[model samples]
Target: MLSAQHINKSFSGVQVLHDVHFSLLAGEVHALLGENGAGKSTLLKTLFGMYRPDSGTLSVAGTPVVLGSPKDAQAQGIAMIHQELALIPELSVAQNVLLGNEGRELLNYGRMQARVRPFLEQVGLNVHPATPVKRLTIAQQQMVEIARAVARQARIIIMDEPTSSLTTHEIGQLYRVVRDLTARGVGIIYVSHHFDEIEELADRVTVLRDGRYIGTVRQRDVTQDQLVTMMVGRELVAQTAPPERTPGAVRLDVRGLSSNVFREVSLQVRAGEVVTLAGLIGAGRTEVLRAIYGADPSTGGEVRLEGVLMSRRTPADMMGRGVGFIAEDRRHQGIVPDARVSVNMMLTSWAKGKVGVGERDMLRAVEPQIQQLGIRPANPHQIIRRLSGGNQQKVILGRWLSAGCDLLLIDEPTRGIDVASKADIYALIDDLARSGVAVLMVSSELPEVLRLSDRILVMREGRLAGELARADASEERILALATGVHTHAKDPAVA
Candidate 1:
């Protein structure tokens, strides 16, 4: 349905794509796999007409074409769904679905909803067309995006990390939608860091490494280990059980913490310990973290830092008391998109009354951390928004590391990060714990929780259902706790 040959793209004189070639056949799901800065986004943008290659030829249905904008691509039966959602929050679902294509005609709410309802149904989104988009969950919003693409009659669609924020059940729904689209002869170019998704959905997998095409292979023909080797030219060591440590005095103590989403959550993280909150989506893990950091209002609770009651639990108060928070929503809550890497990294320091530090001094101070975290482009002056998701996450971690906080509250630390970057983050967290920085984290990925946590606390229905030490923690046990299924054996650790 679409093809690009000899594609080369550069940004600010730095080449990002080199003689890259990609093709999509009708009714097939072609997956594009890569690490954070491996040119995946650039290639997708090129295909979707958000970017023009320096040297390349794009052909649609055997005819050469030049796409000057996304409109041109849409006219040529191509659409893209970005990882960060693009729908207007206040707009109705129908309005967003038929946004540009609504024509210059007079507004007709009834007609608009009627026309957009079929597309919504086609994507299995059950909400009323007139419903406000912000009221829908992330999964529903994604379906709305797909509904819009389907409404455009797009023959080719690019989905970037569509399941990054979805739960297991929601992911299954997405798979069904993809299959339905493919059955209707719609071609898809899927991008994700999750190998299991690619293995399930992709007919063929093409890999890019450091802006260069590595190779393409049939999904069933290659192991994940082989793909990892292609991605990083490495056989990464599997994460093993962390060594046992005797944690120091309690650093963060939450007693009967209650919020709108959760109730009476009590937990303690000792100095030098890594305590992970494990749960399904909407289990209030994020709210708990936010409440602890004073980002969310707590109806009741006492948060103590090293036995001192924190009567005023504001963000500045927590930061002043040697606490740092890494938010789950990196795009909105965690980063200053317009700021330079140095500025974003030094935000905490500046907030703590280091306002006299000049830009040069800030850059010099954060340079070591930037290098240590392996932030790509390696330029402190670079705008952080231009970096990949994994690199952006690294900068956020660098922010806290530079702040030299004693306690860290991290939520989904590696949510959208690639594998190599995830390992880097894991090592960094381990290092922090070893250095006596108390770590409290929330993670939905079972493997990550198992790999990193000194202790796992499972939350179900916004409450702590049980707790498991590192030795007793397993995927099955954690799920049992999370899903509220009683284990046959009476385990003392479970509460």
Candidate 2:
């Protein structure tokens, strides 16, 4: 239903998409795979009328067409579901679904709810249509967005990172929804950084690298390793080796931690050790880490670093205690978006009365890290907002390391980043552990927990369920602990 030929797009004298061609046959789910800044979003915008390409043509149903805006594309039976959902929080599900197409212009919610109920049921969303959207979870809100697109009767739907925030069960529901849509002859363009999702849902996969089309392959014809090579154009060096540890005295010690959201939790991370907290979403992993760092006020807890007791205080106080935190939501709590990379990188150093370091020293320190992390543009003066998600994360991690932090409290260190960038972050963390920086991290991806952790602490329902050594950990053991499943076989790989 949608196809593009030789599309070329540019912004501010830089080409982002060149000689790119894509197609979405009716009743097919096409997967678009790329690392950060590979031009996947650019192609979607060009097809959705948000950008007018400098060259090439887009067609609908074999007819060439030019779209001036999203409305123009919508009128031609195309809809896009963005990663950040656009539902109005104050409105009900029915109201958000029929926002512009309220039929009689009189804003009758009862009639709207009745009209929206079928679409909700069609997408397997069982919530009442009258329910306010803000009351739902992230996964529920995403399903509501999908229902909205289905209500538009669009022949082509573009889903960008739809499963990024979803849990395993919610992702399964989304997969079922996608299958239902494809069964109805709806063409879908699925853009994501997940390889497993593509393997499960994509009928065909197209790879992009550095704004150029690499190639397309059928799902059954390509291995996961091959797909990684195509997307990055290099053999991925395995960076998952566990870090060597020469752990000394305990650097971070927490005891009887209690929050309104989390129960009593006690843990210790020693110097030169990388310890990770692994659990499913909403398991209070982020809460415990935030409490230790003083970002969240804990109802009760005793924390110490290097044998000095810590007080219930602010983030700056924690920093003064030789602790640094890398928040999960980097866009808000981490960086100054309007500032330059050099400024953001040196923010912590300046805040700590280390202003004697000149601009040359700051840039010199960041220059090697920039090269190591593969941050694009490699320009210290570039605005933080101009970098991709993965590159921005590298800068944030660089900020804390440059501050000379002794202990790091990190949450979801690589969330929403691409695979190649994930490798860079993993290696950096592994290096930190080797350099005697105690690291306590929370990650939802099991592979990460297995790859980096000297010890994996499993949290379930806000309590410590179990702990596994690096030599004994596996995906099954972690899942069993996270879900409260009893198993005599905690480490089958130990033998």
**Tens digit of lDDT per residue, candidate 1, span 184-232?**
9999999999999998999999999888888889889999999999998
Candidate 2: give the clashing pairs. none
Worst 10 residues of 2 by lDDT: 486-495
Off by over 4 Å in 1: 103-106, 353-356, 489-495
Can you give the TM-score per candidate against the true fold? 0.97, 0.93
lDDT of 1: 0.91
In candidate 2, clashing pairs total 0
Off by over 4 Å in 2: 353-365, 488-495
Candidate 1: deviation at residue 384, Å? 0.8
TM-score of 1: 0.97
